[model samples]
Target: MDLMQWYQKAMSSDAYLEYMKENKERTASILEKFSIPEEDRELLERIGEHSLKVIAITEDWCGDAMVNIPILLKLAEAANIEVKMILRDENLELMDQYLTNGTSRSIPIFIFIDEEGKERMVWGPRAPLVKKVVDDENAKLPPRDHEDFPLRKKEMIQRLGNLYSTDRTIWQEVYDSLKTSLVQSILM
Candidate 1:
């Protein structure tokens, strides 16, 4: 099915609702406080009638998804665009097609499909700063050091948690990038 079909199906799905409900804390963290700036709002408005579909391949329980998806959702709403989500586990074939680094099956992959279901762009995993923290922290760990893996992971988690908690400008950054990307995609 195309994105619109999937979107309609997902919206009324009890399973999907359960997923969202289960991740209420994560979702609330973003949805409760996030807002679009005037400039971002104007950019979204310009995308009016572009008939875009943001096919978000994600799992509700994913920490990254909870933080970033809501920000994209806000932009989609502003642009009057329909946002669709496909659970990664349930849609393995689709998810596999858009894997991170062609190996890691990362959650929260945002596939921008047009009215005809042609993918125009893809984004995922996390924002740049978050990715940096994850990469840098992981880099700090020594290879095959099982003894300290847990400790390193915990420390990385704490750093990531702090980053997400303190960062409000990430949303604006998302808006700016998406605006540039959308423009580029169409001009090709």
Candidate 2:
């Protein structure tokens, strides 16, 4: 199905609306704090001039989704750009068309399309490296039988902290570049 159909189906779910309502206050706070540079802000304000569409794939249960989706919504509102939100699982066909490397399915994948429904730019989580980091951390945990599993949870926390700090830098770069590209593309 097309993006609009997927969005309509996903939003029709009572559970999804409940989740959004429950998180509304927190989501609003997150959007309020999201900072974009003055130049980027001005560029984004012109996003709809060339007719661009943004389809955001996300799930309420996802931490990154909760954070990023709100920011995207805020940006779209400010730019007067239309946006459609779809639940990742419920929109597998749409998501599959843009899946990173044809396998990994990550939330908050922003698909940017021009007026003709041709993809202009796609941005979201990186591939293999992300899976590797998550897998490696999972491997470090002792089996369910280990008596000291609880104590070793600290090691897991530290590992995740290190992974996140490194990953955050990479993600930030991608996000900034994507924002600049999207703005420039729309203005052109």
Give the alpha-carbon lDDT of every model.
Answer: 0.70, 0.61
What's model 1's TM-score?
A: 0.83
Lowest-sum lDDT 10-residue window in model 2 = 8-17
- lDDT by residue for model 1 (1-188), tens: 65555555454223443558545565666766787777666767767567887778888767677667777777788888777778888888777878788999987888887777777788877767667757887888766558878887777766665565447766655556666677787543
Q: What are the root-mean-square deviations of the candidates from the true structure over C-alphas?
A: 2.8, 5.5
Best-matching candidate per TM-score:
1
Best by lDDT: 1
CA deviation > 4 Å runs, candidate 2:
3-18, 21-26, 126-175, 184-188
User: So what's the TM-score on candidate 2?
Assistant: 0.64
Model 2, global lDDT? 0.61
Count of backbone clashes, every candidate in sequence: 0, 0
Residue pairs with backbone overlap in model 2: none
For model 1, the stretches where C-alpha displacement exceeds 4 angstroms are 1-18, 21-23
